[model samples]
Target: MNAEPRPQESLSGKEISPTDPARFPRLGFLLGLVVVYWALYFVVGAIDKPYFYGFIYGLASALLFAICFFTWWWGNRAIRRSEKILGFVLIVGVGVLVGKFSDRTVNFFPLCTLGLPLVATLVLGWLALVKRSLISSHWLGFAAAVALGFGVFDLIRMDGFDSSLKTHLSWRWTPTAEQRFLAENAASAAAVKPSVAKTVPLHADASTWTAFRGPNRDGVAHGTNVPTDWNSNPPQQLWKRAVGPAWSSVIVIGDRVYTQEQRGPVESVVCYDAATGQQVWAHDDETRFDEAVSGAGPRATPTFAEGRIYAFGGTGILNCLDAETGKVVWSRDTKNDSQGKPPMWGLASSPLVTDKNVIVYGGGEANKSLLAYHQDTGNLAWTAPAGQQSYSSPEIVTIAGVRQCLMFHDFGLTSVDPATGRKLWESGAVMKGAPRTGQPHLVDGNKLAVAVLDGPGVSLVSVTKEGDQWKVAPVWASKDLKPEFPDFVVHDGSAYGFDSSIFCCLNLATGKRSWKDGRFGRGQVILLADQGLLLVVSESGEAILQAADAQARKELGRFQALNGKTWNSPVVANGRLYLRNAEEMACYDLTPRRQASIR
Candidate 1:
């Protein structure tokens, strides 16, 4: 009865009839707008020349927008039977494009292109099932598109695709097989050599620092009565010459002084005139290697033996050179065939020549442990089961009436039958350091003292024979005496070596610090007992001559010889001292006759 029988209101707000084309058109237009906007967004993103991640992001945006549009369009077309299939095809086509784009950028981790599309598909599929409307079919279409996109991306990211892409992009960076072979051969060639006759020694009595620790490997000079006190100036510089970079010490057989140096790509075994420090001859071969901790060149001291010079490079290249000429006799690349990867500080262990066999720590398996190669032919003779490879050179010592080769390995100290590579006995002396670099010196032919740098202090092991078996026991252990470069020398019942910075002396019998003072500044030391002095070379190339006493540290002389660091152990022979830095070599005669002496 009131206002014109007011308009009748229905519960269902506006009846959306399936037969109404206008309502469906409006929905289709809305869906199309969303699709167009998404496509535009993707196109704009792709224009920025994006990398993998950016490309994936762009594809995702485009796919999302297309999904929304298709879903709305599906709602519009589902009402008309003829337009439904067409709407589904369009949605599927849009999905396929999204999937293809997603595949192009899957290399980006976590934010995977395929992952998002697959997730969107699953989510849309759920939403579609929840709503049984035409919009639901649209979501299903979107899901299908995402799945297709994911599959495309997966296929494109496969190994085969990568291979093809690499082939297409191959350039000079891709090394040819021939180039690789040549490089490999060059590395292997370090082990081969030409033969040269050894020059007769100028004088047999003119001693040289033959091996690492000189004649006895005990850091003791035999029969050379060097005066303890000089008049005013100790000695003179006979001569001085510049050598290449190396940490190797000098080995003077007679008139010639041999050592290893790095020129450029080759590590050369250089021989100099002992009297004048003149460059005599150098055997250069290309065996270049880059190291971070240790300097480039040779680390092992050249062993002058049987008319041949044996040298080990920083890269584990062992070369036998002619004593006179710079000709190579035979070489062996321990890096290629042996399990011996060069130590972190480089191969510092000099080759030990015993009888006719040249012994070295090859770091091979148990069968090829401490290798004994024929000195003449470079042929493998025998190998002992050395537990671990050591940077310390093997010392031939007669322990307890039996001649044995004493060597240090990663596990501990070991003695091997020098004749047959047989293990005589091994003391379970665990070094706190992972790698043992310094050679253990024998004290009075009865006790052995070894120093480790990184961890664990020095230990003196006494070797004794118990019936048929040899026994070694820790006499004393001291954490105070840590040597980073070389082992301490034990003379007159005392151990003298560098401990981090301070030069220390300890009693061999008791690991007690007798005296620890006079910081040598983080360097390695070589004890010259005959001269009654300790030759300490600091990391800063300062050569110090001090008294071999633990009670009172007395500095006799000091001089800075080189510009670079001096990690090389100095060699003193025939009253002349040889020192080397990374780029220069110097010789100082500590005799009363020379002009420039230790002043």
Candidate 2:
């Protein structure tokens, strides 16, 4: 006996059968999931703490996959039977083939959501609905996907990731920021300038900024009064020029500014004129440190002390250069000297130049994490324990009437004697597997504030010194202000910095948030202590001035400082403001002239 005719419907001028056998049977369901998948991506940026952006985006992408896999199993109650087993085999085989042959950087989440779901619905769904062919559609799809795996992705490349963990992709043939800068500068290059480092005096009062995060490494500019009224007394651009790719902040002394950059394969310590923004000298090391996560170049800033420029390269080389001319005084292989493995993002510890020794954190190993070499002789002075990893630089501060060197590592905060490399005190780590960044902020001389990513945020560790021993413990741990990589500064009994991507103020006394306002990405804040003002340089290179009050936030003025993703810290010295990122550097005249200039 003949079976009753199957129900037929017309879609797009083609006759369709509802129960027709098909390679991708649940096209309607997949269409719905794709809609939901796209919606999830649109909202992931709205999540708090950009470092936690993966939590939402991963969950949303996994939800559709989990449901797809579950339904695939549940609907096929007899999938093991001989008659129904072919579809199962085909599904598993196609997945394995595509995964194994696709480009290494091609993520599965995007593949499943964007490529497979949508295309399968169009091709297999149409064939199943029209010709009622399951095996043919399956074979055709397998062939098409295999072709895509070997052909389409070879032309693409991953540039890097933003703070939100979103992948930045580009064409493989496109020129990078460093390459474009090199080509442009070489075309119109002028004659090489002589060394001006000798003409400028390196010695200055406490006002000169010769270290990362300013003179004290506290991210505070003391005594200078920055003009807050940008409308009335706007900043004038002294000079704007392109620089090599680097995350290093600039250090200013006299009329000279020094920083690090990656030029081609060489990591250079470049000295530029603070007045003309001219290149005076550059000490190049024949090495390169390039990674996809944070792009490339040096992460630590150059330190200036006692007529010497101390710079730590990204690949773990330390060099002491003469401040008079760019001559190498002494060089040490820090990675080889300490015998420790480098971190994922490279050794970013900005060298701390003390009276006798230059101290830096170590790689993973017992009693080898903190290495202090002689300042002039380049001899290994001493080594201390500092856990496995840290991007934080060693800081010199006086706590409880005792001067000690402070360093932040994966585990926690460690205070050591600068002269002896003795471990004075240690605190426990907050976020496991998350290496600490940003130097420790010492509040009230002893209270230390340290922050971590994807963890319980910043913790206030109380450091005190007793008769013969030292003690360190957390006074209050909180998520009130998670600065990620940017350093926070304490002023007027209150701490101010970025809470992930937003600007926030925290009361250092109570750990309570005074007020949280503004989205500044991952930028640094320089507290102009004399003017009671805060100069904020955002990740996208906008400089904003706001009232440094704990009660309420008020924006005084803002101006475009640079034109790229800015992660490096800014420097202000001798009536000038200097800012740089991976792309370019600029000198602005904040010299109380009250004139606006843009070039």
**Model 2 weakest 10-residue run by lDDT:** 7-16
* Per-model C-alpha RMSD: 17.8, 4.5
lDDT of each: 0.63, 0.75
**Model 2, clash count?**
2
**Could you tally the backbone clashes for each prediction?**
8, 2
Q: Give lDDT tens digits, candidate 1, residues 1-599.
A: 65543222111123344344423233335534544654664565434221223435555765665576556645653245445565456445545554455433233331232344344444344433444443324434544554554444444432111100111112323542224434544564466544433354633354667887686676766656555554356545566555666667878777678888776677788877766665567787788654533435677787877678888777777788778776888998765546657655566678888878888876644345577878998877787766556677888888778888987877777788887888888875554325676777777778777775224678777899989878777777788676654457776778888765567888777788898886555567777666667777776787777888767888877777565556677777777777776656777777765455322
lDDT of 2 by residue, 1-599 (tens): 98976654222223345454322233455456556655665676556555655644565566565467447544743223332354345444655565566545454644554444444434344434444542333445544543453334445565666676666677767887888988876664565556544456787566589888987788888868666779888788988999999899999877788999999989999988777777778899999888766788999999998889999988889999997688999999887767876677888988998869998876666658899999989999998887778888998889888898988777767788899988788776545446578777778777887776225577787777789878876688778887777888888988889888889999888888999998888788998888888889998899998988999888998899899788899888877789999999998888657554455
lDDT of 1: 0.63
Residue pairs of candidate 2 with colliding backbone atoms: 362-369, 411-429
Query: After best superposition, candidate 1 residue 564: deviation in angstroms?
Result: 2.1
Q: List the pairs of residues colliding in candidate 1.
A: 99-149, 103-153, 191-331, 235-596, 235-597, 236-594, 236-595, 236-596
Over all chains combined, what TM-score does candidate 1 have? 0.64
